[model samples]
Target: MRKRLSAQIAARRKQQVPADLKGMDASLMAMLDAQIGDLEQRIKGVIEQEAASAAKARLLLSIPGIGPVSAAMLIAEMPELGRMTSGEAAAMTGLAPIPHDSGAMRGKRAIAGGRRALRHVLFQAALAAASHNPVLKPVAQALKIHGKPHKLVIVAIARRLVTIANAILKTGIPWQPQPDS
Candidate 1:
């Protein structure tokens, strides 16, 4: 779009402009193009930073629903997971559903809080984890059997991941996803 606009402006410049003014316009166009190039470089730098995040994500990937992006987001955004309880961090990730209860009639469980982006990645990872990670399969299967919605089961796994990640971060250990006997 910028290229097209630049070309259009150049076209107008050629049609209605003195020779002196044309030189000035060309300079301005060069400056604008330089700025645009700089902006593109900055954007690349920001995207590269995701690698640092992805590194942490690698650890989480071992457990269940947590790939590089999700892991990176959690590490970059929630690096303090080490300070929180497994469950607390899990709840913070919004993996745990909110309990909606009032008087005689109790309300159904619903998800309320969490890092939605990280949650998304976690669940995406969970789908893959459920198939390969022996430990996550049964839990996923059970949730499926109970008619816990597919998304919910993934969220449940995500919650469990927070717990595990927290523990690992705090303990300086990797996750040990054991097989279900």
Candidate 2:
């Protein structure tokens, strides 16, 4: 919606529209942004209001790339986070790779099922982690160095992120980089 509004504003400008008409999209975009900010704040407040959720949110936020929004989404969408195993957590978010195989033929793997919105949020988190996370950074780089496609790399990172989140929540431990082996 924001991108479409931006495009509309650009198109209107290109067409040399009247000043008032030109301002409509910009005003609407500003309104949208403000509303989004308000909603995010409300989400944060709700998460903090609950003891269990606040703890989970804190653990999630401890991860390098998970911000308040991502933590809220995970807590809300996947309440089973701490109880599930790494593979279960990944599968719950649709970040797990599903194998496609046939008699004597192995097809490519792909992710499917699980919470769609959560999967998208996790992907965004993984993208950030791929860039800024100490542990995940090397894993992402190695995949790229090995010729993995960008989306594939991000999916793999997302899967790992879920696994890490699960372990952290289960053990009630905040994320900490492990020593190099």
Candidate 3:
């Protein structure tokens, strides 16, 4: 909405816009920015006050691409992280590919039927990991070389991320990136 409003304000400025309209756009943008900042601060305070959440967030932040928001979301939404298998973790995040095959015909696999919100958040994190994570960058590049769609590559990375999260939490150790053999 802020971006939209800014675009609208720019467009209006190009035309003959009144001073009042410009002021309104500026005020709205300011309010939106303030509200976003306030919410982020509140979230930080709440996370810090909760011992378990703080621990989880710290563990998650040890990973290359996982940030505070993603860590918080994972802690809040998926409490079963450490207890699950990699496949289970992937399925929980809706990153596991589901196969639909009829008799005598193999069907293409696609992901579906899991926590939608977590899936979206994981995808966002995966996008960052694909570009920046040394551990994940090669995996992403391999998929790209094979002609996988951008979305598919990200989903694969998201699945790997959930698996790694599970391992880290279960072992109570921060991620230590391994050099490629």
| lDDT for each candidate structure | 0.69, 0.87, 0.85
List runs of model 1 lying over 4 Å from the truth.
1-58, 179-181
In the range 83-147, model 3's lDDT, one tens digit per residue, is: 98999999988888998999989999999978887888788899999988899999999999999
The positional error of residue 53 in candidate 1, measured at the CA in angstroms, is 7.0
Q: What does candidate 2's lDDT look like per residue over 41-114, in tens digits?
A: 78889888999999999899999988886788899889988898898898889988899999999999899999
Q: Pick the candidate with the highest TM-score.
A: 2
Q: What is the TM-score of each candidate against the true structure?
A: 0.63, 0.87, 0.87
Let me know the TM-score candidate 2 reaches against the reference structure.
0.87
Q: After best superposition, candidate 1 residue 177: deviation in angstroms?
A: 3.5
| lDDT against true structure, model 3 | 0.85
Lowest lDDT sum, 10 consecutive residues, model 1, at: 52-61
lDDT of 1 at 62: 62
Which runs in model 2 stand beyond 4 Å of their true positions?
Answer: 1-20
Error of 1 at 25 (Å): 34
Q: What's the CA RMSD of model 3 in angstroms?
A: 4.1
TM-score of 1: 0.63
